[model samples]
Target chain A: MAESKKPDSSRRSERSRRAIYEAALALVGETGYARTTIEGIAARAGVGKQTIYRWWPSKAAVLLEAFLDVAEQAAQGEPLIPDTGDLEADLKLVMRATVDELNSPPYDAPARALAAESVVDPGLAAEFVGRLLEPQLQLYVHRLRSAQDAGHVRAGVDPRIALELLVGPLAHRWLLRTLPLTHAYADEVVEYALYGLAPRP
Target chain B: MAESKKPDSSRRSERSRRAIYEAALALVGETGYARTTIEGIAARAGVGKQTIYRWWPSKAAVLLEAFLDVAEQAAQGEPLIPDTGDLEADLKLVMRATVDELNSPPYDAPARALAAESVVDPGLAAEFVGRLLEPQLQLYVHRLRSAQDAGHVRAGVDPRIALELLVGPLAHRWLLRTLPLTHAYADEVVEYALYGLAPRP
Candidate 1:
């Protein structure tokens, strides 16, 4: 409903793409990954089946692109982890933003559907992680590497694994619904992960 | 196919129940939670529909019970986390066992199905956590509390949240398939979570 008044070919194509993404996300959210189909998305988006098939090879691919589009918009095309020199505050700010995004209605349901589907489907899981999840993870890796260079993080720490120490808890809590993923919880995750759980000198 | 030679009521019931758990796990593993049905489970288990209905209210209930049975048997009824004096070694041992369970075929597929279902289904997720995940988490909580008493952990650390630093990485790696969840990765999770990512004193 929020398309531009301009009728250029580029504008029209963008509108159609956005509409298809919305339809795909809503379908997967309500009906789940198993039932969501390319035909269903095309019908809901008011586009031809050929159009969807032309743009993406399969329903999984379409959904995957849609997910990437949504996630990019969620971060507003900025790097997820900021490099503001002060690591702790930056981590808190970014993590708090993640908490908000994870809670937001537009992104929440479809992401959960995709995540749920990925669990049983190994190939899908690998593709989704490689394309979508790992890139975002690399944002943390970049930030952590910068942190280590700044001496904010230990030189001995592996940025890849170190990032998991941060992302894993939030993902676990968010995906499992075991507890509330509040800003407070996000802050605590950062604090505990950066400091020794043992008695510190 | 493994029913007993004995025709006594209790013995027959026991065999039937095992068959049902096996059937439910297989169906869910292959077909996923959305498509798995009580009728299918009944047919696969060689039991009548009324027999399934007599024992469980819904497919969710049947799957839940089946998952509990499998998880229990996976651990061989051992305590999830050992209460040995060294918290790091104990966590690594438990996490290694977890990696093995997650790799095992019978437990892997069915557990993934149940976990995936739980993500989008609130009631199922709640029951799964309350009955399965959290009870297991509380086992770590007990171990952490013991660690605190032994002066291995900071008294100020919340055992509940503290345990997440250990389990969350493993769960995230397992559920998402972002990385190979090996014993080495498990050991790294234990090390990073315990001593943390910052340069130590």
Candidate 2:
């Protein structure tokens, strides 16, 4: 599954793309969203401005794709969202992966930088939610709906809101630095959420 | 109780401080965190750079105090944290008030600007979290502890982590633009959090 690529030209294109993505991530991590520009990215990547513009429409688009590439790599080329038969285990595994991603230096800095920038910039925020966050969230939506069909989750629950119960706490903890974002914390969130925080007989 | 007991010169200092605070907020809202500076605030408020420096150490400090003052006012002269005997009702009240403030023009724009700026800048973020976010969160911690005492929340529930269930969804919505933040949403978070999302008899 990993070796589905073609010949020499594709290899060069892949190399350029990887370089550009790394440069974009590093620049944003170093200089922030406002100061990281297309020109600067191209300069850092050893590509012309038109090279980047040909592939992506804007800096936001480039950065968004760069982040996706990073996430894809970190997932060990695993699909961005997985659908193992067990919904709770599947969700917990993904959330734990996310906690790991959010803690690691490369993913942590750039993602937080972009997310923080998006908090205020509505245009950038719209792009972020549309391209980056929502698609990933929709994977969970699909998973939860499947869970409902299988009777794992309550059929009455809004999958979107239900999904937030799982993801929101992690996102909240990561963004705010409120506490340690550990596998244990991720597992507890899953446990507390699936069983409910209230006492069970 | 709103009245000050300081002498004439100190009262003059108080007035200038208020003006500086107002100026800082307005400037940050208008131009965002990056563009806001002591010189602009001073110029807008018709105070000297020395005047701002005499009172606060940095632009972030000025903005922090400005936001704190606004929070204090929006609180309508109430305690920073409300502690009614009923825990759920008190939290619901505070979260609803938060929704109102987040939706209000007076608080929304400036707060968004500062929060966005803090995302990339660690120094600024630390200051923002320490001064503004943590103090407010402590109120909930105190209230939740009180609830633990009353046996409303589970005895083993960590107040800080538990409070996130209450605060996280709201913040997630507000920060991520995932949903319309409203009074209804606040009440829903309170319910979903205190009870569990799973089926309950």
Top TM-score hit: 1
Looking at model 1, residue A63 earns an lDDT score of 93
What's the residue-level lDDT of A94 in candidate 1?
A: 93
Chain A TM-scores, per candidate, are: 0.94, 0.90
Worst 10 residues of 1 chain B by lDDT: B1-10
Interface RMSD in Å per candidate, to 1 decimal? 0.9, 1.9
The per-candidate count of clashes, in order, stands at 0, 0
lDDT of 1 by residue, B129-173 (tens): 999999999988989899999898987889888888888888898
lDDT of 2 by residue, A10-64 (tens): 7778888999999999999988888899999999999888989999999999999
Poorest 10 consecutive residues by lDDT, candidate 2 chain B: B192-201
Highest lDDT: give the candidate number.
1
lDDT score for residue A82 of model 2: 71
Off by over 4 Å in 1: A1-7, B1-7
All candidates: CA RMSD in angstroms? 3.1, 2.5
